[model samples]
Target: MDHVVVEPDSSSFSRVARALDDEASGEQWRAELATDLHAALELGVATVRGSLMGMATGGLDDGHEPLRQAVSASVESQVRMSGRGAGARIRARKITLRNFVNAPKRLNSRRGWRHPVHGDTETWVTQIGAPGWFDDPLRRLHARLHSAAARALDNRARRIARRG
Candidate 1:
């Protein structure tokens, strides 16, 4: 894959983090950076997460899946969903992900999710160091988990294969 390198937008994370720091001082603890981080995370890493979700449930539904494939030609999703980001460690999520799609790719030195806000796409690296942690690990884990889930559901896969 031809990896695109996108320089991080300098002010995005800081702005969000600063907003969190300023607005979240009360005892309710309902609002905090961690919570903010959780919500903000999906924006940047949706692609990676979506991809994992697809792989994990590969055979579950033929009708549809999340982020179902890579290199999708249609505006509709190409990759499938699974579940997988944040932080300038708050700016990157703020700026680039405005129109971000969860197409995570390993960049040089930094693992990246492509930033697609502007016309020309740029692959901005995530603050989270590991790019596709949910990626290969999920693929490996899914093979095991999917089999296990199938067994739990009465070993249907083998039966289906044997029937075929």
Candidate 2:
């Protein structure tokens, strides 16, 4: 029999090995951590939504449409928070939203592998602050959304483990 040894370099095989290590140490602990992290994230999201909604309502006068416009403007401002000029603003909004939805799905699908606990946590934390903000409210909202999404994903992972 011939044996071939290969080094891990961001490959699926190494990923499986890492997961096995996590499971061997304690799957339950991992699951609990994931749950806690998820809850924190969800809380962040709610906070952001609340802040945005409050801002909209507080600014609204006799016209109800202004509230809707305010919400839209707030979100648009966050999306366009980056980029060079007008064109960059338009592109940034589309790209940011698209990535926001897609990135979570991609991370969630990785439940098949074992991830480093701290590594995953750091990723979520970094995501919350990924977008720089001139407006405090928008910055908070972005951070909250990121945290919430991450928490939701951790919850899903826990559910999956429970099923198995």
Best by lDDT: 2
**Candidate 2 local lDDT, 11-127, one digit each (tens):** 665666566556535757555555554454444434444444443122224433443233334332112112574111111122223123332222223232332333254442222
How many clashing pairs does model 2 include?
Answer: 4
Model-by-model lDDT, in order? 0.35, 0.39
In model 2, which regions exceed 4 Å deviation?
1-136
Per-candidate count of clashing residue pairs (backbone under 3 Å)? 23, 4
Q: For residue 90, give model 2's deviation from the true position in Å.
A: 13
Candidate 2: residue pairs that collide: 19-114, 38-151, 41-147, 41-148
Candidate 1: list runs displaced more than 4 Å.
1-96, 103-129, 155-164
Cα error of candidate 1 at position 42, Å: 18
lDDT at 98, model 1 = 23
RMSD of each predicted structure? 26.0, 20.0
